[model samples]
Structures are given as C-alpha cells and as structure tokens.
Target: MQRDKLITAEVADLLRPWFSDVTVGAQPVIGDAPAVLEQPDHAVTLTWRVGSDDPHDIVIMGPRTQARYHLERPGRDCLQLRFRPGRAADFLGRPLRDLADRAVDAADLGSKSLTAVVQTIADGGALAASQSHAARLRSLAEAIPVAPPTHTDRAALHRRIVAEATALLSIGDGPTHEPVHRVARRLSVSERHLRTVFADRVGLTPSRFVRIDRVRAVLARIQQKLPEVSSRAGYYDQSHMTAEFRNVMGTTPDAFARRRWPTIEACTAGNG
Candidate 1:
C-alpha cells in the first residue's frame, strides 16, 4: 500500500515530545528472512492490528533491554503509538520497571485513555482507511489525555532526574556514553539512586539505555558505510560497532543494512 506522510497541526501540537511516532498501516516485508531480530527500544509502544477481525489484538509493549527474535506475519495492517523515552509513565500511569522486556495486554495496564483510543479504532474498522491520515490521527489525539497526574515531592524528584538523565544519555561522547556515576553526580544524586529511578521510569538501566540509543542512532543512518557510521555513532571502531550490533540487534551491521525493514515515518521532531 502507498503510504501517506502528513501530521495535522492539532495532533502535532498535542503529541509532541511525549509521543514520538504514530505508524499507520505498517506491515513487515519478509521474504526468506529469518526471524527479525529487533533491537532494544526505549519507547514503550501500543500496537494493534486494524479491523474488527482482531479487535482484541491490542498490546502494550514496554521498553526492551535485550534483543528479541520474532517472526512477523506479512499483510497485517498494524497501527502503533510510540511514546517518547520515560514519557510513557505519565500517560500509562504506572511504573515501567515491571514491564521491561515484556509485552502485555492493554487491559493489564489499566490505562483508560489508551483503552478509549483503541475503542475508537475498533469502531472505525476498515473505514478508518478511507479517512485522511491526519483526520484519523486527530481522532486518536483527541481521546488521549495530555496532562500527567500530580506527583509527590520524591516522585517528582525522580521524574526530573530520569528526564535529564535520558537526555544526557541519549547524547554522549563515547561508546560508554555518560558514565552512570558521572550522570548521578551531575544530577546531584547517588549512582544507585539514579539507577533506581531510571529503571522505574524507563524500564532499563542507564547503561542499557545508552546502548540502545547508540544502536538506534546507527539504525537511522543505515545508508552510511560502517567506518563512518561507527565513528559518528560513538563506537571505538567498525569491529566494535559490529560486536555491539550483534549483542543488541542479533545481527551484524552489514547484514541488517541490506534487509527490507518496515518503513517508520516519524510524526514528531522529538527524538525521545
């Protein structure tokens, strides 16, 4: 199917920085390919196939620490909502640590807002395709709550630390990125304290977050050569980049660059 890339101004204003992308009509393209080894994602995702045939297919996927191997069936029209790093806690209204590397039924999260949005999709069914992409996104945007709940002093402190830490970790000087201890020091908190808060909010440790962020950076620039991509992505060398890719992506950089992965058009400017 031909894809449309457009974001209505109203939806864009509402979902910025918190929700990063809304992928409509996404289906994997696999031909004699082994199980796709997906890298760790910092954003928690809500995914459900379109149409009433699978109304109950809604899933809430938490941030992953390790790589996962899964065979995605072709020809399934999937819609996904990807929340920015550490921002899903506000919308989902729960700690993410328990959800690390897990995929659960949307009902399990007890998020009324997400459930309502899913209902809208279910009601729209195949007719949703006839509407403009911007119109559909506006509908979903309207159903979602923009404001986060109130937090106590300590909870607020943790949220602040996690937010700053995620931004710093997402952009670092080397392969190790910002050391956990150093980041803690900058935030005026103990290393252990930062780790605990980060895990609670992001569902992954600071180091793991850095690793995944680096891989994601590399993934975004698959058109470049290994040497250039490695250096730009803060890897020690091409070999180091390949090894890290193997560990987190379950495939070498060269091989992955050649594969026919699904197209993901970002709907917002926020990289988180």
Candidate 2:
C-alpha cells in the first residue's frame, strides 16, 4: 500500500500528537481505486481534499445523522485528522451523527475556525492544554443524545466482535460462500454469538462486513492494474465482481472507473 501523506498545516497539527512518528505523504489513484465506504467508528476526522474544477470532493458515509463520507476525487489530495468519537462532538459542539450519510460542503464549517484549530495543533501546542480543551468539549457534547452504542461494558464482548470481524475481513478473494457455522468453528465461537457481536457493534452482520471488505480489496486491485482484478479480489468471476460492486458502490465497476476514478485520484494527490 502507498503511504498516506499529510500536507496541510491544520491536518498536520491535529494528527502530530498521535501519529508523530509516522510520515504523511500524497497518494495518486491512477486506475480503478474507487473510494470505498468505511464502517463508522467513534472518532472525529477533519479532512480537506483538493479538487479539479471544484474545491473539494466530499461525501458523508454512515447510517448516523452526523457521520459522513468525504472524498477528494480526480486524484485531488486531502488532509484529515481522525478524532475520538466524543472528542469530535465536543470540539464541533454538535453530534457528529447529525451529519451522517450525507455530503456537506466543507465551506459550511467556516474557514476561520477551521484554520485556527488546524494551526494550533500543527504548532506543537502543549498536550496538557489540548487535553483540557478536549475535556471541555466532551462536557458540552454530553448534552446531546445520540442513539448509537455509547458504551461497551464487556471487554470480552468487544474483543470477540473485533476479532471476528477481522477474521471475516481477511477471507479469501470472494464473498464467503461457506455457512456461518464454518466461520464460527474457525474462530471457536458459536455462530449466534458472532452474529450478535457484529450486529451490536458494527450494525452489520459478519457476512456483510466481509462482502464490503472484499469489494474494497477488489477496487484496490483494479487501481493497481493487476491482470484479472476480479480473481485477484477473490471474486469467482467477473459477474460476481460486478454484483458485489453494485451492492456496495451503487454503480457498476466500469462506471466507477470512468466517472469516479478521476475524482479519487485528485483527492489522494491533493490531500497528500
């Protein structure tokens, strides 16, 4: 995989504390790497993607009201800071779920505040002060009531869910045709337990997440110019690949290649 580049001062500042040792750089999507939809997590991200004729290519992804899928397309680059769930709500003064599943223009956030926040982090601001700000934000965010799972009391439950999902996502090139019993046996968990865990945490069944992961891998392969991308991504054939592509991306793979690839390329380049 190509290394992710972080260029903007704001993005650098926000992420430097956590990913200080990692290098950030630009990525170019030259071929079929359509931006895949990601499952929601409890994190806040501030991202900017450069555009062609447009200023940014952004979309919101997720079922929640505040979660969004933002993409910088046509190979435009982007810089983003992924924040913990509560932290985003605290900093933004609203539930992130309010923005879910819809794309909003970044210009909506008012450039001044965004710039200031970005610059503060980039300047190597004191961690103690940042923590204080984060606490203040959380206190304010507590007033809003969002319905997604807020707490997981069972450490074992959380581990089981994450581990099962990881294993499912690591399956071979195609969607799993094997029954849940087979997978459960491999993981040493009952099928029922696996299903419940995934539904509770990810809002999707284990099978669905596997399909999404496979589709994403397929998209990545297409971008890399691999011969027979379908086979490479674990699809049984081109037809299987097409079906999975439409299921997740809402368009045929070819259309995505023609229409969306350029935008993705732009986002990767501009963000880096």
Candidate 1: tens digits of C-alpha lDDT, residues 1-272: 12236476677777674677877543233345455445578878877655433435677778876655555546555567787767778777777888877777765667777677776776773235576656766776776777555568876777788878887777444444566778889999988888888888888888888788888777767668779889878778889888987787767778777773333232211112
For every candidate, C-alpha RMSD to the true structure in Å: 6.5, 10.5
lDDT of 2 at 156: 44
For 178-233, candidate 2 gives per-residue lDDT tens digits of: 45567777777787887765554444466665566566666566554433777667
lDDT score for candidate 2 against the true structure: 0.43
Taking all chains together, each candidate's TM-score versus the true structure is: 0.79, 0.47
In order, candidate lDDTs are 0.69, 0.43
TM-score, structure 1 vs. true: 0.79
TM-score of 2: 0.47
Best by lDDT: 1
Give me the displacement of residue 44 in model 2, in angstroms.
Answer: 8.9
